[model samples]
Target chain A: MLDAFSRAVVSADASTAPIGDLSALKAFVASGNRRLDAVNAIASNASCMVSDAIAGMICENQGLIQAGGNCYPNRRMAACLRDGEIVLRYVSYALLAGDASVLDDRCLNGLKETYAALGVPATSTVRAVQIMKAQAAAHIQDDPSEARAGARLRKMGSPVVNDRCASLVAEASSYFDRVISALG
Target chain B: MKSVVTTVIAAADAAGRFPSTSDLESVQGSLQRAAARMEAAEKLSGNLDNVAKEAYDACIAKYPYLNNAGEANSSETFKTKCMRDVKHYLRLISYSLVVGGTGPLDEWGIAGQREVYRALNLPTGPYVAALSFARNRGCAPRDMSAQALTEYNALVDYVINSLS
Candidate 1:
């Protein structure tokens, strides 16, 4: 051990790293930002994303429109829908920032209490977030022949941003997991 | 049940490296906010009796049946338990304020509380309302930064959510 330590103390190769190549690092960062931009593509139609998701949730749970349910009262329905939009807005923020704290701190920090105080339904809210997650992932999946997100990324000159698209979708999906678990 | 230490360790465990500079900065931010929280807690720590009294008074005013002496679950017993809980919540909030997180409340106090209240046939509304009273009646001392106040409100809301 003493011999090895003496050898290491005398070694320049072990202490010094070659610093000529940076393309790999640059490519990594560029790809990461590209994936982020791909995720942000879903941002333009955020209202549609949230509304469609909530529409699906309300469809599955029709009781939400009936008396005594959370969405039954006109004001209650507005609040429910507004909250869906708020959640999606925050989810988008998290996705774009590549961090969950923005969503956790701003929108979800006291959301449970606010929901309980307003008698908002947790189960329905959970489902709405899930639906949004699915829809957002769909928007990230690249399509070669249309009916998918292929045309969206075609401007970047890649017919197959396949793995990149898949990873971006995966990251986007996980942010909603935080929301679901927060409500859970 | 997240505190600065647990949160940093978890992040490091997730990424398999030292917690990054951003993580350290986030901790610093929480600690900065915590100074305000500590001051707020100190203000409330000395005034527990007055805070608890006003909370009970406000709750009784809102729900008069709580004033009854004859009803078993509806009046005296419920009032006593409710007031006790409200007092504990104020103290718990004080503790949480100093800790700068809800870790204490979730781990030590509120876990599984929803079911406990349900099993006891306790009305959650009264408890929730009493908590609101305790905080709004100035148990959450007025001289707090907006950031500190938001953190305090979040903990109170967390307790209310657990009950409801």
Candidate 2:
């Protein structure tokens, strides 16, 4: 029930990070908090974002929405969307925590096994996660309203290559890569 | 197998819990040393066959009695087994190095060692000697960085310590 900020703080309490690294983590967290609006944006739009993405995937894989497919029934379709949301939520936790282990252990560790057992098509699920990842990264790093602006222009106005925000963004994207690989 | 440290972190993560400061440090350290570890792993892995042959020759020279009748070193199977074990340990070390973590070498690396040896009617001493020689000779690569060498030694020594 804790808000993402509270959750991030709570996760930060138990750490063996060295003095300097702890400071770095603290700074990163502070900077991340400034960017909390992205998480907020994603949270606010998650359902529609997930549904639209999955609908596209389902549309392309026409057989899937037909009889006896992995997501044949409307109920299965709903489950797929729900699972996508769950994955997104956990990915957000890892983004805030600056660690991939959370996503790895909770969401992805046995997912392939579970999917196999339940007959979920991994390819569709992977595509869905990829869709979410792209959307989330866009929100985190860019303003959709300013679609014409180059992402580089935004960076040019700020820190250099070691830009903390850029680094965190890369880290966040890596989580998506991790998830995609796990599902793939 | 996963590193013990990563496994523990995974447990904490599953509980939706935060990390202890040490855990953060550990994970970050792995990230920092990742490149060097992978470098060392590449060097060792690239020379796997050569290292095995060199280590085997050295072991035989040091303990000629192992080549006697009824001894493990005398049989082609046991000799092959020695090569196989070397490859296994080296491969595991390479994984740990590339991953920048000292995985549970004891659990996945050295575990079942005795059973394998017994099954092959192998002597522990010669096998140990050959492994030590492999580590010693294989690690002598001049191109490896100090950090890479340190990381390499840490993993191989960890396996040796567990066994010896």
lDDT of 2 by residue, B1-164 (tens): 25423454455456644344454455455455655765676677677667767767777787888778987677898778767666667666665664445543454567787787679676666556666876665444475878888888788777777666
Every candidate's CA RMSD? 21.9, 12.3
- The local lDDT score (0 to 100) that residue B37 gets in candidate 1 is 62
lDDT of 1 by residue, B98-151 (tens): 555676567556887778767866666776777787656443335465655666
Q: Per-candidate interface C-alpha RMSD?
A: 20.2, 13.8
Which docking band does candidate 2 fall into?
A: incorrect
Looking only at chain B, model 2 earns a TM-score of 0.81
Q: Is the docking of candidate 1 incorrect, acceptable, medium or high quality?
A: incorrect
TM-score of 2: 0.55
- Fnat of each prediction? 0.00, 0.00
Question: Candidate 1, residues A1-184: lDDT per residue as tens digits?
Answer: 1111112212312432111232332332345445445544565556677788878898998998999877878988787777887777666555544457656776788888887897777888999999988877766663333655464533324435556477667877888899998887
Write candidate 2's Cα lDDT for A110-181 as tens digits. 999999999898888888888787777765655443555456323213333344346556766788899989
